[model samples]
Target: MNGSVTSQDLGEIFKPIVESFGCELWGIDFNNSGRSRLLRIYIDKTERPIDVKDCEKVSRQISGVLDVEETISGDYVLEVSSPGIDRPLFSIDQFKMYIGSKISLKSRIQKEGRRKFNGVLKKVDAQNIEVEVGKVDYVFPHSNIESANLISDY
Candidate 1:
């Protein structure tokens, strides 16, 4: 099918399928080209970092399943790999996972003149994130966030 399926549905379909093989599904991006399509899967694991073989294995297996199921009914390339250093903050758990680390959060709501906030992740509550700014902590609602990612330290 359709990509309009619930996020939970897509997650359900991919989670077990990937984790069953001992891999964490990082992301799934379904997009269109001029007349073609692309299905990219980003994966992760604990031990040995994702190498070529790891990506190959996941790509091959996932490709086989997607091919037979025909969820994407068009010409597409399947790409699988690690999240690298700059991974997307997907959930509250993920945000919690990076507490104390630097992050860049952007939302529709404006504060001081922009929608971006750069600060340390102080806390990741249920529906909002508390970021320490100056002497005050600003709570940002998760639903209003357009995107969030870790700020690399180098």
Candidate 2:
């Protein structure tokens, strides 16, 4: 793909590949920073926990496809793995799934005079999610979220 390719574009491209392996494409994180670039793909399986074999299988397929499609320019490391316990939340559906769980998120822009929030996920809707930090509930539009991740109870 081109430099302009968004995460959503990569998601659309890989969703089918991931599904063919009997897995769900949980999310994709592409970090292009400094001299190195990293493309991280998180996959999930409903039936069982993901293992190294699964990651290797998906990695091989994705690597081949990326090579043929030139999906990413220049040198980049491709990593395929599970989201883990402190899984990063990518979609609104993910947030919905983790309702009532502790989460921390960073917004692209300051909301209520803060860009970072650590709280209990109270509610999720189509457009927004409510997180209670301390006793105050904060509503954040989905578009404003830069990154969010569950706070592992462990």
Candidate 3:
């Protein structure tokens, strides 16, 4: 899969299958690396942590579905796993959940001469999020965030 295959597209195709196994589709990461593409599906459960069996079960189900659907253009590795403690933040709601927690993120475009930010997520509203990096507070539009992950202090 190339640029044509989006995370959203794959998420739509795989979310139902993931949910069927009593887990939530935390996020999907599709990396197009020339001939060797990698597709990673992150699964989560509110009550407890996901185990190897959960990963195996979801992997099998998704593998079968992908084989049948043929949505991808070429050969790719499919990995199903939990979004660990340093889990990626994909949506605004996901960010909201981490309020007052530390996060490391990269912005698509530089803001105030900086594109990278590592600090506590101070606030989240409808359009933007505030991060307190050092003593300065920076407000970044949600759309500008290229990638964000919760910081595992441990």
Candidate 4:
């Protein structure tokens, strides 16, 4: 993809391919800051736990499409995998799915001198979510979240 291409664009490009494997496109993470760009595709299947074979299958297909499309201009590492236990939450709907679960998140901007929060997910709405850390409740706008993931006990 070009510099103007966003994760959303990548999502559109890859969603069909992922779904063809009987998986949901959980999310896409493209990191270009490092020496080598990394494109990570997270896939999920409710019917069964994803295995190595599943990832390999998706990777091979995606790689072939990427090569043919030349979506990415330069060399980049492509990874296709399950979200695992501590799955990253990429959408408001995802957060809603894990209500009452423990979660940790980093915000793009500090709130009350804190940029990181680890807490129980209390509530989720269209615009924001409420989390309880200790005895205090914090509300975070979805737009401010840089990253968030469920906190797994296992």
lDDT of 4 by residue, 1-154 (tens): 5655678888998999999999999999899666788999999999999889889998999999989988888778999989999999999999999999999999999988989999999999999999999999999899999999999998
Q: Which lDDT tens digits does candidate 2 get at residues 1-154?
A: 6766778999998999999989999999988776788899999999999999989999999999989999878888999999999999999899999999999999999977789999999999999999999999999899989999999889
lDDT of 3 at 136: 92
For candidate 3, what is the TM-score?
0.93
The models' CA-based lDDT, in order, is 0.77, 0.93, 0.91, 0.91
User: Which residue pairs of candidate 3 clash?
Assistant: none
Better-scoring candidate (lDDT), 2 or 4: 2
lDDT of 3 by residue, 81-138 (tens): 8999999998889999999999998999987888999999999998999999999999
Q: TM-score each candidate.
A: 0.80, 0.96, 0.93, 0.96
Candidate 3 Cα lDDT to native: 0.91
Off by over 4 Å in 2: none
Cα lDDT of candidate 2 equals: 0.93
Model 2 / residue 99 / CA error / Å: 0.8
Model 3 poorest 10 in a row by lDDT = 1-10
Q: Distance from true position, residue 93, model 1, in Å?
A: 1.0
